[model samples]
Target: MKKLIMSKTLIFLFVFSFINVFIKFFGGSNTLIGVTVVTAMLMFLERDLTIEPIKNTFKLLGINVFLGVLSFLAVQNIGLGVVANFTALFVVGYLFTYDLKRPMYIAFGLQYLFMVGSPVSANEFPVRLLSLAFGALCIMIPQFLVNKNKLEKSSKKIFISTSEDILTKIRNIKENKNIEEINLKIENNINSLKKMLYDNRKDEFYLNDSAIDILNMGLSLERISLILDNYYDKKMNNNASDLNNKNQEICLDIMESEIKKLKLYIEKEELIEYDINLDEIEDINLCEFYIVLNNIHDYFDEYKKRKNTKSEKLYTGNLQIPSNFKISNIHMRGLSKESIRFSYAIKVALAGAISGFIMDYFNLSEGRWIMFTIFSVIQPYSENCIIKSKKRIQGTLVGGTMIFILFSIIKDPSARGIIIVLAGYLGSYTTDYRDSMIFNTMSAIGSAAMIGSVSILFINRILFVLLGIAIGLVVNKFILPYDIKKGYKYLVDMYERVNLEMIEEINLCIKSKHNNYKMKNLLLVPGLIEDRMSLMGINDKEQKHFIKEQKHLTSSIYNLYVNIATNKIKDNDFNEMLKESNCISECEEVKDVIIDSIKNTEDIGTKVACKNLLQILNSLNNKEQKITV
Candidate 1:
């Protein structure tokens, strides 16, 4: 939290506030209101969805500007305006979902919806469009610059924090806390680390060897944590008396020392070396503990050596972080009915269109609120959509009522600005939908109040919000409804198909020179599965185990394929050379092949690839069962 306050989010937020204040000081508070509200909405979109905010900001603004013009023209004719709203919402929704893997506007697509909401008035159109551009620039430019150096910052934070968490949980077990609960929290953190690393797989091309070392470091920590969790689960529950009086103390001491060393590394980038002689511990109960500490020591020592030996990709000519947005592949993966991505787009388009038609025909004041609600409330799945809709109503009722009272008491504009800022921030910091919406409603309504009657705006905003959520819910349930279980199965089928194709491609690439195409589903499918599993919230032990294992297995196969292809070991005679290694035998597992190859291979690159491949495949073979909740 301390680190958060001093960094990018804070810095850009300051810039955003300053720019909005400047706009407000010059009688653009209406524009200021628009700017602030839209920026808040865009915050969810860009921050959650895209890594390249600076680039994405430009791309999105260009689309918004074009559509803003079209919306202005369409609004001149009421009939055309309804159609335009539907078409704009539908097209943007569908095109963005074209890439199934999110930041698929998972949280908000309000920025685009806001663009097409303007009426036929020429005056309002430019203000809305210009405010959006100004609002986005104020935030995204600083965000891009501040985050430019933070490419590996999140991964490193996760790595260091989760490592500390594991050590802390180990200590907590000694405190006689609920061992199961401690272990579950540790597992969730571990999953967070994996999700962050995997979600950014494509961006990894920009990561240097050192940055990747941080990611690998996190994975290693997860492995060590898993070992501890499994060991403790059995030992703490079954051999409680035996452990408490025996190796637990010794192991705890070792873990405490490692925790200190881990902190030093996070602070100074210093590596650790375990001073303990594991041979002397001699305690049967703590054997795994000693082994893990030894592995951590080895990892740091190797990390130190590689830090010196490997060229930093950041400085290397081979590093090719694209300066422009890469065109995402636009091919449809399946029928609209089967895909969650398409279902979401279709539901959003229909809801927005139907609601827009109703609002326009009636010439409803703040009619866009209904469209916005529909867009925001209608999630990919129905259950979540239902909850979000309820929260949207609950938040608006509670927050709108409170803000109305406060704004009535204080006629001071500056006071309202203060309320706006505080409410906006409170919303951002909140995690729960209802809780954040309380603050978000306060902020949003407060912003709208700057230009209109608080009473009229409040009442209409409340009415439109309620109306919108209703339309959204109806559309989501009836219009191409999505099933979480079915979605998981679709992704499972995709994973099977994509992995086979990937392996085949690896085989083909090695056999031929045609290695140019690799399926994007290789990464996307597993990620989608992860997202679905998270949404489904599966609690059954066996089901979780199978899903986790499936993910690991696919990841392992992908890793092996990547290693072989990356090393360009197409012509390398690891198979034949393996027969000469005295330890080599016929393949019982994939690791056997890598083991044999690494044994005989003298080429540094092939040996490295083989060794890394060995580590990856070991994940599948590891006796320690990884824990998740």
Candidate 2:
């Protein structure tokens, strides 16, 4: 109770109420009412205070204003208004995030619908715009003033925890214990670390480049995991000569010692010195490990250099708007159909039109809530809709019950307003929490009560919300229902295609005697695959297996690219060697198999391609060893 009272949410709520009071007492125009709604809507989007709240608040405010004006201009009829809403929703969904839960316009989109439904004359648009701008500044200025010291402290905590987890996973691999489980655990930790980096990037006020360094370090750790997997494979499958065995032991010890030193430096806040020698390794796999180990050392060296010049104050008050507004950039890749985005845009438009029609037919008051609930419950995938709808129904029932009890007991309007504001403040903090539906539903009920314009009939509100959910289900499932299985298959094919492209690029790099191509697509494949898998809700075991296999193939090819880049293959007949070894034919074979599988929707091609690709990798590794020797 005390923590809730002292939370930053309470600060926001106080500012909100204070602004409303100011506008009301000063006889602010009806436009100010628009400002109040816009400001309140923006407050719902304020999920993480760890980020640059002021910067994001301003950027989102700009987007809302843009959409609001567009929605206003395009409200000629229901058809055009739906078109405007669809365009706005699609653009926001694409540019803002691929994550459904964090749709950049989740609140703003609903507001646009409300504006469309309740038309304002063109003469008043600018005043409402200015009013919105003013309200956004008022809300964001206080957030900027409250500099939470915990931001930097939390960053350090994440750094230490991530570093510790990495070292422990390395230790586990060395012991050959719970190899699969440990690798999955490490991957999860790395993902958490990456998400932290993304979250911190939003905090432009306290932007730190060290997080970038940490992310690079994490990638190096993943590369190390690949090296370890290859090492284990070689050790298990092939018999090493006595000298090679002794050399492998020496290399492993040196690598482990360096990792321990890196952990100590990160945990103790000390400068690091590089102490690994990579010049004398006989094993090709160990040489690859040595290269990544040196990369990790370089990260620490760079960190030490920047540590001396680390800024004193984390908050700088410098903020830039996000610039992800390019429509051409949002290709329909991995979405199975080119028309998927179009389908979703139309679904939202139809839902809005249908919702408006229903409201008009029934003479419903507070119909905006019905439209809001429709979009809130409906998702691109039917499975997501079903899950969300169930939660929404459960939440609405409980919230409506609570509201009924509260209003039944409390008769004073002022007292009910204060309680509603307090409850809304508590709900604001839990918008993204696990039980967010319940909290948000309760908050909605409280808000409706405070407005007190319509009758406070809890049953009517619940029924209206249920009507919206039913409409959403019918729209999402029966009308152009999304094929999740097909989407998953498309992702599978895309991952393979990208991998093949990287290989072909590497082949060209060797043939052209240049390494200008950086294989950026190779780096993105794992993340893209992971994102799709998460949306589809694949198990950890499946995700790990796929990533492990894909990582192995990419790591092998990347090492070969690095070797060629470093002029290690210049004196050798690289093209002639590749021809004689049948590497190209093997690659072509894998490509053909993948194409067949994608065409037939069969896993046989994937299985064959993975096997052939691994063989090609092992063949390349042997060739590298012979050339280097």
Candidate 3:
């Protein structure tokens, strides 16, 4: 909270200071203030103020600064005509290096168009660009510093806590003289470490190489824990207390040896650098095992509940639920089919053009242009977007009224300076809540002041703004509209990609000659599964059903693939087992079931096929017990 407040304060100060400097250098003009306010608001909106790694933030800052300087110099030398197109090309090229090429390219194109047609003069272009750069820097710097400090502090604490926990578990093992207790503690620690590692996946913050290396070390510790558990279990069954003592000592020795090996691996691999080897991650299938274990535990718990108690209603079986449905009175809503047809770029561009045309028709282009610009990117289906738009419109009206009254009271340059300062404060405050009204109000006041300075009537400014918002709202509701289908298609495409990748990995595992090679491939399945599940919540019933069916099939395939990979690793021929157990037939049945589920639109067919596939896969793989829940 302190960090967020500090970051906001720093940004506010930076913008205010930069505006002051600009006003000093070039007498405050309405056009200049309007440009400044717009650019500052854009920077605040675009900047990701979330806690992130210092290195990444610094890297982004350096890149943005370089790009800004390049853009400015390009405009200076090549003129606006050449720089306009080239600036877009450069932003696109930069984005290509980051795998977000498509969206960034579209953004660059729109920004290029906006810059080219903007009323701001060529003489003020450099200053405007610098203002934008300064705004970006303000947000990035404080956020970077605070996040780095917090991560460093947090990493140290987690390390100490984890180490202490491990040591305590070992001490308990030594004192209890009971292997089962020690085994359970070690398992618990492994589970905790697995959760930690999984949580860190795709995280944008905390780039601590040591913390990541320690996680890798935990994988080795897990292996040691498994070995110790096996040893203890064997000794206990044999009733060999003397042997048990020796085995416990042996377990400790083995654990020490493994820890030394892990330490050497970390040192030799230079794992402390944040560049983790994707191949190395493949070797630990801890996440996959964690999911399987968790599911099985849940299944057993439900089974126990069923066995222990009699309910008023007898077990009828699993409740059947369709993934997708449309209900009209229950506030039924879906993506506008028209909106889905166009990408975000097209939607924004169209919205801007339509809104501008409406204002132009009404002879209120200037006020409406601002409204159009704000709503262009605001998604139609989004509640947040609606809220922001309404707030922005109201803000503009209030700000315009304020500017009219203020201009009547204070005609001096110093009063204008104070108004500028107040506008800066309002702008900064808006960034904190993302309240569009405050932002719109600030822009409106700034715009009115700019127009008023040029001898335009204050009443006319207010009327123009109202006219603009009216057109903007009309365009938003009627023009193209927002659609949910696009999102559904996106989810479907992602699902397909994940399945394709899984198939590719499984094929690679099957063909690999080495024993441990397949283990790495097995590890990736869980993360892919997790990604799919996360998308499920955001989808409609039809989409959800499709995802569920895909998940069921994928899970079965993963289990089969794991069993095959394990057998190959142990240098055991599983052909006899495969043939006797009807594995091939079961695989074919599972494939057919999935294909049928995909073809059939009805919920019943899909659910039944999914259940059948799950059952067959479970029956075929005796190593993996069937989940009865």
Candidate 4:
């Protein structure tokens, strides 16, 4: 509750600060309009409100200001509007090379082109661009400060709580004599640790090489927890009839006491470190530990099996690419030069057309400025287009509405100043909430207020904005429909890519002396398998067949790897087993026989042969079975 209140307060403060800055620097009635539009755009794009956004916004603002000044000077002899628009477009293209930061750069570029590039007088462009740049800086600085402060607070709490939890869990494991209870507690703790690791690892600042190491450690702990749980459960079941033994009860009491001590240590808010000595547990039953160690060893062996299989998949590199570039391509797919060029061309054409129409309708005289906005801001097809479209529409409607309302309310020139101050407050709140609708509405109201105060007094301005939204929605839905089939294909392709990569990794593991590589590859198998299974619901028959074959091959290889790793058999021993069992040979032979048998119109001959091979492979022990490849 306190955190929520604090967050809201910071938002309001930022909005208030932005409005004040805008009025002080720009003073035009439309200053609020610009703020609202930019704010709405920010909300639409930034879902998580991470620190990266605040930093990126400021960096973009600085770049825009520098470029705007330069362009203004260049166009002093020519026309300021033309130079500003050109500069904005060029900067947008250059800065947008960093994928996530593209939106802000585009937003600034458009703001400059539309708001400043108009009234193409050579004298007015520099002042307008400077005002625009200053307005952006006002909003960006406060946003950055607020976000950075929030991140710092959140990080401190997360780490402290996580560390305490880990220590408490460790102590519980030390105390419990029932073993089953201890194991359960340990498993729970490990799960908690894994979740924390996942959260931290996802955070941009936390994504480092150490993050992967932490994840692996978390997994190892989880494995240990599981082993301990199983061992205790088995022992407790066998000794259930002898529950009244005093010595057993005493040992249990001691374990419970130790767990309490560990909890106390954790709660003390001091780091506790200790070296674990397994040999010191000579007095207590050693059977449980032995069982746990044995299981851990076995788990590692099984992991290697999965790893080897994955490496093989990665080496093959047989993943299929989508046929349709525009509809089917994903961001993960490496873009070809042709595709990039095509995107650039489409963007330029679309922007030119859209801007031309808007200018012709509004009779704003600076129609070319609209082209700058469209070209600079529009994302490529590879980005998540559906989300972007929704955001864009929402921001425009909301900003437009706000501008209209503010203009109507602030009819008197004297009250306009106060209303502008109020608009700033509203902008901050909208930006903080990161809602496209609210931000756009606020921006629209502000812009209308700035543009002739009497314009808002006219009641039909709201209708015009709504009409614009309707048109935009129609364009988005029908003109270039977002295809779900294409999205599914992209997912299928990603699965294939991951699978093929895993196969390659497996091949490397086979040749390498280090077994860790094999284990790492195996860990990736279940995730890929699960992904493929999920994609099956969304994919076509051909994709399903491809996934099925890949799954079968990987699963077979996984079993073979497991047999070799767990039993510690020689390569020759594995080869001999594979030869004797003839699993691979039989599978191939069955395929050939099935094909020939189908041609011959023979009844059950192919089926019988396939069934016989399956039965033999199923019955054969790992030691006796052999693989051909």
Candidate 1, run of 10 with poorest lDDT: 579-588
CA deviation > 4 Å runs, candidate 3: 1-5, 18-341, 354-368, 371-377, 380-387, 401-416, 430-434, 450-480, 485-489, 513-629
Question: TM-score winner among the candidates?
Answer: 2
How many clashes in each candidate?
A: 0, 1, 11, 47
Q: Can you give the lDDT of residue 384 in candidate 4?
A: 34
Per-model TM-score on C-alpha atoms: 0.67, 0.71, 0.47, 0.47
User: Candidate 1 — which residues are off by over 4 angstroms?
Assistant: 1-54, 95-108, 115-130, 152-157, 166-207, 227-311, 314-327, 395-466, 488-532, 551-629
Q: What lDDT does each candidate get?
A: 0.59, 0.57, 0.42, 0.41
lDDT of 3 by residue, 1-629 (tens): 79977887887676556556655654453234434343533443333344334544464455444544444443233244244334433343333211111122333333333333343456766665655445345445554454333422443344334434444444555554564444444444444443343323223222223333333344434433432333444444556478656656555543444334333432343222122232222111222323232322333334334334632122133422112211231112222243232323334444444443444345443534443344433452334345555665566566656666676677786777677566656566455333545445545555456545523544555555455455545555665555444444554565555554554544444564322322322233333333433433453566445544454444445454544554422212223223343324445444443444423423322232233334434543533344321
Q: Candidate 2: worst 10 consecutive residues by lDDT?
A: 318-327
- Candidate 4 Cα deviation (angstroms), residue 196: 13
Q: Write the per-residue lDDT of candidate 4 for residues 1-629, one digit (tens) a residue.
A: 68866886786666556556666665564453355445643453332333355555565567656655654453343344344444455445444432112233445444544443333455556666666555555455545554433422443343344434434443444343544344334434443443333223222223223333333433433333332333344344556445433444444344345334433443453333434453334212222223223333344334344444542122223322223222234332323332332333334333434544555456643334235324423444433344444554455555555555665565766576566555555454444222644554454345445555434422333444344434434433443332445444555555555544444443333443223333443333333333433433544566545544444343333333333333333334223433444234343444444334323422222222222233323323222443310
Off by over 4 Å in 4: 18-212, 215-352, 360-362, 365-439, 450-460, 463-467, 477-480, 513-629
